[model samples]
Target chain A: MLKVRLIPVMTFNGVSLVKTKQFTNARTVGNPIQVARVYNSRNVDELVFVDIKATEQGRKINLPLVKKVIDECFMPVTIGGGIRTFEDINDLLGIGADKVLIKSKALQNPEFIVKAVEYFGSQCISIAVDVIVKDREYLIHQKNDEKVLMKTFIEKMHQCNVGEFVVNSVVCDGMMNGFDKILYQNVSQITTKPIVAVGGAGVPSHFTELVQTNYNGALAASSIYHFTQYTPQEVKKNIE
Target chain B: MIVVIDYGMGNLASVQKVIKSLKKEVKITCDKKEIQKASLIVLPGVGSFEQGMKNLNDLGLVDLLYQEVIQNKKPFLGICLGMQLIMEKGSEPNECNGLGWIKGRVVPIVNSRLPVPHLGWNNTYKHKEENQGDTLLNNFYFIHSFHVLPEEAVECTYVDYEFRMVASIEKENIFATQFHPEKSQNAGLLLLKNYIESYA
Candidate 1:
């Protein structure tokens, strides 16, 4: 049987690795290279490095740091955060990134997804949809407070030939409670794309629940792996 | 020294990093002389089959590659799109001729509940009869929409993504894996190490 992937997500602010609370109150975590080295020894299925400050700071992801992470880790690396143009994706892939994640860029220009898919194949492209439930409705959040319907955004990306998705919940993001199951199921139903459920993964059972719910993979950040309980191998054992 | 052929396609740095981690002298180049001097050749690629073939042809490496692997019997390994290029022809990104080293046809993976690219980790099961009790069972990362179907190559291992698909193959001096061994953690590294040590 194919194993359910347990991915450890590491967020970066420029060059330093940091953890966020609902996408704010960013706290320094550790060196991204050192953190990735730990995950490398844990036999992790994959690693996601999101540069949280890229788009907001009006600069591209730190390619030098990306190279450092790629050099230290052997498992497949999926880079997210602040990817704007095709050249950025191409440059990253060239330097050993297995996949590139697009968020604000995709929402800003839907055609970017089409062009990216055409240029780099859908397998290498992933979109991270950050969702927040506000006043009895789901809204996609980015740079602005502008509210974009989750279903509509997903539908547009699906049509653009997106291969995988990371449906993250802004409300549940630094809480470590558990994933927003209802939102994930809804997004999964909308498209057949492999969805990586992120945010609010606080325990080992949370991983099992994700596998039971048929989520293609589960991503956790500050919850179980911040030098807490359940290493990646332990979580994989629990999921199995 | 292991020479990783670079033809303007795919991630060659990761391959070089892994090989270096293994404490082996490795080089990434397109120079024909370097390829000739290396003890083994690794063709690692990811992209359209047509484009990959065109790059090799453009670099004028097809004949040198054939001479190294066939004439010299130097161990050769092709990974992902590189593996597909070993076949006689590929159907994706329009039909194009391949290296014709292996007897196979490259075609799109049969549609299933899974997406077309077949991304993520998958269990690799070695053939029971062909098994030599080597460690090939650990999970390996896979991300390809097309697969190679060889006519006469030995199917060392296989995976069932709704259908029985070829995972790895072994011939006289050639070895190829559909999965990205460079990206497949410890098991993948072990496979590469085995190739480097055993296939001479």
Candidate 2:
């Protein structure tokens, strides 16, 4: 009786919360803590907070901002962006983060994912696979403007035994159209790990459509709670 | 005071925050003296069974917890890894011995065609018909790969994920759950409140 999860993905720019389109053209949305409080009231399944600018700024996600957000909500929070070492993971978890999302670091040094799983256990460590579709193929998108075959990256990380995979589409980000079925179909062929599909969800049916296909969860940013009139609870009702 | 035992495994802060919000006196400590002074003890953890036992042993908390929970009969609650550690043995990363507080063995969930780490919310049903109205029977968040199989009949609640899996257990002064009540929101908060009111 495992229920599919509809999680809200919050993109932060170190200080303020922002929403991105295609992983660029960041637009400041609202205060991080206030957004968290609203989600808390709605009782969303889980919350994913990524400091989009942390990697470019060469620092970890703003801890004070994260701590304040954690205080405002009493649910699972996944912290990501600019995580380079084990200390960063420990610091985030110490401040009440349920799981640490590793993106750039996991690609740079895959060994870190193995070590992280060995030390913190698979339940606490999740990897975010940001991808872009090119020529009808998925490519692993990196901040340094390098792209690798998505299949190769996913197969390699699957061997590390991480808890879950967050398959996010950089091209479809903030588009509010719908999810990329081909992207999910491609990743599903590689591994059976729990997947949280991210990017390009415009409506509640968009979530239902993805969940009915393959993903165990759907993560949204600009749809439902952000840009539309539907609340998370209302979306959950639609899914149910 | 309710003492949340900290063995450096999982999110102790969220557990502390939830208990604090309930307006109950709570403390997160591994100190022996503080534990002895506590009116109730809560062990909340998230990790593998082997590592959890290792950390508890290295911190010299194994014996202390045994004395307080088993011998002294102090009201005790174990969450996730905490609940699994009460079993006599577990086969997660490898075969390892547990605290043996309960006569059971922890093993990978059976008949679950779903993912390994069965992560998400699921509805739980009370084992006893009379306990159908139990607040803990509501949907709760769970994130784990293993479940316990008690050797003896104990009051329990179960969730069906291809098979009936133990979700929560209750014995005289011991109460434990495989799901995280802290992260479960309203249903979770109500469960904690019920536990505190019944024991503390």
Candidate 3:
């Protein structure tokens, strides 16, 4: 059986990128190239580059920025930032984006999902779910930063043919309050596709303990780098 | 040199950069002679199957592609829509007919828990003989919605799902990855390079 691996997501908004959260504000961390090199040395399985600025700027995947990412990183790189069209998707994927994440695009024009899969293949596409806890239930968050009921989004994606999903807990996002296993558990029971749980990073055991089912994997940021709590290498060893 | 078949609407440059990352010789070309001359050929595209098929027909490269892969037996690869094109026909509303190199139908990953145009990177199992992980499977990227049900299911190596559909197929001199090896980093580039170097 192929075991679930770790995918460290690095966020970049506007021109500057950040590794850690400074209250509600995100702070600049280091150069993407340098951080990627650190992960590379650790034999990290995959690195995700999400340009937070793209959707708002009405831009596409930053190929030149991607070129900068290509400079120092040598692992399987997944670029997801303001991707809204087949042409944009093609450009990024063509340039060496191992995987492209579709969030708002899928919600807006579900056909865009079909268009992507028809052209790229399902595995090449990933659906990212920004999660939030409300009224004792997990929910789906969108690019407009709105949280919708989970059932609707899941249904929408299922109808369209999404390959995998990343359930990111907005509540647990930066607090390191431990992963919301409940959220993953809820989603996994319903979906057969691979689920990557993002949002919180309380600790390593939190990952092993919180994620009850064998199918889902937890994704964290601050806990791994700035907090100096766990490195991707260490997490990989523990998971194995 | 690996020749990237330019259908004018496919993912060409990305594949080119990926090949370059592995320090391999590659070119994106629409010229038939250049395609014929290359030791390896790649058909990479991103669009509806109907549009892709139409592009091939309009460009008049379909016959040449079939001739190159079938008669000449050069190692040929099709990614995403490229892979679906290998099938007999795509059942989507697109009214597309694939190259028919393999006996199969390209259909929606029906009742897909995931959305259509199944996009993103998922793991792949290898074909029975190819399960040992060749230049292709080390690490690969994937994006697609429709999957081929090869008449020769036994020819399929790895399987993933919008619903238990094939993700990759290997039959003799012809090999195709349903995922994007180029976008898959070292694994993607390595697979492309390995395919290029592996003529036997």
Candidate 4:
């Protein structure tokens, strides 16, 4: 098995890097270069720079912003948010983004996921799934931001041959309360690939506890970047 | 001095920047004289197989690159489309023939489910390699839609997404990477450093 990675989430607002809660209440945290430098120095596994507003704005992956992050980061980086075209993915990879994340688009056009894998090779493909409880079922977020059944999408995505999945519970994210293990366990039971849990990660032990059972890694925004009680290394140490 | 073959297709500045990071002397030149005299030459391209070759021909460097990299055996490296150019032919175009230095062809990354233009840091599954990390294409950064599917992979880096294309190739004095080692963080930087210390 490949090494389980610990990816710290760096969500962007326009060109500036900011910290937000459940996709709201944006707060200026620091520069992307400075934050990336911290992640680099701390010996984190890799970093993910997500543009929370890109989808809402109907754009592709922010190339210049990705370049800015790559210019400073020493570790591997995975980026998402508004990546909608092959050209965008190509340009992003060309410029320097190590990996590109797709959630809504994969749901919209599963063939894009397949073509993405074929063109770049499957190793570069990353599938992201945002899950939430709707009428007592785990539903997925469609491209139009609508809700659909999760199991069907997960099954299809696995068929798409995505290397990894970043599964975050929409209701649980940014709350720093905890992770929705139900969502993780559900996906883990279905797919053999690595799964990284995102959303509501508040403490160092949270990551450790999650990886113990099934999930490969736990991603946190508030605990690592905000509370400052533990470094990514320390958090990883606690988890391992 | 190492010459970064100026084909005007790829991220030249980044490649140049990476070479500089290794504290090595580099020149971005299409001049065959300058390139031929250099100790090493780099061929980098970002566009499709056809346009890339067209650009090289239009710039009058296709033959120049062939003479230097293929014939001279003066340590040559290709990145992405540049790497594909070493193969005999690609799906690029009819007139868009590669240097034919290596025996192979560029095939689309084939799969029914995955998307086109694979983009990301896919872990390399080395295809039985003599070198784990070298001048280029180790466990490095990769971003592309098409790759050089060599007849026999000389060296490969393994990754999880799929059996990745040959990460790096070493034949005689020629070396190339389907993935961009320059953009591959420390692993990539180390490759450049190796090029400076050992090959060049």
Best by TM-score: 2
Clashing pairs in 2: none
> Which is superior by TM-score, 3 or 4?
3
Poorly placed runs, candidate 4 (over 4 Å) = A58-63, A85-87, A104-125, A141-145, A158-164, A189-195, A214-222, A236-240, B1-16, B23-39, B43-66, B78-172, B175-184, B197-200
The digit string of per-residue lDDT tens for model 4 on A5-68 reads 5678887877677766655688878787787877766656578888877887776656776786
Look at candidate 1 and give me any clashing residue pairs.
none
After superposition, candidate 1 runs with Cα above 4 Å error = A218-220, B128-137, B153-155
DockQ for candidate 1, C-alpha atoms: 0.73
Give the Å error, residue A61, model 3: 6.7
- CA RMSD, predictions in order: 2.2, 2.0, 5.0, 6.2
Instruction: For model 2, report DockQ.
Output: 0.87
> What level of docking quality does candidate 3 show?
incorrect
lDDT of 3 at A74: 52
Task: Highest lDDT: give the candidate number.
Answer: 2
All models: lDDT?
A: 0.84, 0.86, 0.70, 0.71
- Give a tens-digit lDDT track for model 1, residues B67-173: 99988989899888888898999987799899998887999987757666777787777754333344334578888889888887465678768877888877888
The residue-by-residue lDDT of candidate 2 on A103-205, one tens digit each, is: 8888889999999988888888888999987788788887566768989888988999888788899888989888897788778889888788888888888
A best-first ranking of the candidates according to their TM-score comes to 2, 1, 3, 4
Better by TM-score, candidate 4 or 2: 2
Q: Compose the digit string of candidate 1's lDDT tens values, residues A57-169.
A: 88988888899898888888899877887889988997889889898889889998998988887888999989988888888986678889999999999999987888889
